[model samples]
Target: MPSLIRPVLATGSLNRAPQPTLPADGGLVLRPWRAEDAPAVHEAYQDPLLHQWHGRSSGCEQEAAGWIARWRASWETERGAQWAVADGGTDELLGRVALRQVLLGDGVAEVAYWTVARARGRGVAVRATTALTRWALEDVGFHRLELMHSTANRASCRVATKAGFAPEGTRRSALLHPDGWHDMHLHARVRGD
Candidate 1:
């Protein structure tokens, strides 16, 4: 009988990885969110598309500030990493890319991202997703990364596909939105894939 399991090297606690600026073409870069970025965060959340899919957003400066604070706390606790996708030249916020649901014990994590309206159709999400995936799989040593989206979110599907996440299957009624239960498309990528 062949062994069915491969041992994953333990990565230990997720100490904040040396916040490196990831590659982003067309004068974009991935960096940590800043206090002053609250306005941008607030503005991005104003897009109806974000509210439709995410179900929540920073409606005001206070909320956006708290949102950024939570992200910082998550980094401290090894729960997640949220990076601001920004224009490298102007430091203008374009969008966000994140690694969430980090289960180090299982060597797995999930990638999520959204682009502001101004950043849409520019491949910002795809590039940011790809960069984050590489950093998680290579630098952070996660064995697998998952990307799930509402089935109706075709644009997200494309982003996941372009970022090298292959669709596995659908999870019926996996998520609940404002309207009702939503079927989710599951996609995943393993290290070296």
Candidate 2:
């Protein structure tokens, strides 16, 4: 007969509470999405510029709710983090910035973001993206971060450049947009760079 010996457990809390949310930066805060954000998200999607740039149309409330639910789940699981950029004063959703495609083993990740049409040319995307990049590299311990933009999106390219991402190269026919197969410009920022 084999004897079973159970290991003793530590006399302390086995499960700790979840970490607090990311702190606000400057006058803008980037935090997890909420159910209430669906309306703003839906409206942002309705912008013609977003549809043209992102190749997708606006969703109904139900659809937006589902999207928000997925985002909340991802946040809880630590698989990814998506922020609803808001004005610190008014707390209105300006857009979203996400750190996704997390390769934990390789310590790498990718960034994606958009600002409402009304927020464009005001440095909203730039500020939000820069804040997210700093958080990913410093707080999340990501070694490499990359952003890919369609060759035709010169505005996005400018954002990447302004955010201190170096132009890595181009991926030929890397994305199939609404127009057709398009070349993608890759930009990257490495840790300590």
TM-score of each: 0.92, 0.87
Question: What C-alpha lDDT values do all the predictions have?
Answer: 0.87, 0.79
Off by over 4 Å in 1: 1-13
Candidate 2 residues 57-93, lDDT tens each? 7669778778888877765555666788888889888
Model 1: worst 10 consecutive residues (lDDT sum): 7-16
Residues 6-38, candidate 1, lDDT per residue (tens digit)?
535344346635556787767778998888988
Q: Model 1 reaches what TM-score against the true structure?
A: 0.92
Best by the TM-score measure = 1
| Each prediction's RMSD to truth | 3.2, 6.9
How far residue 75's Cα lies from its native spot in candidate 1, in Å, is 0.9
Q: Which TM-score value belongs to model 2?
A: 0.87
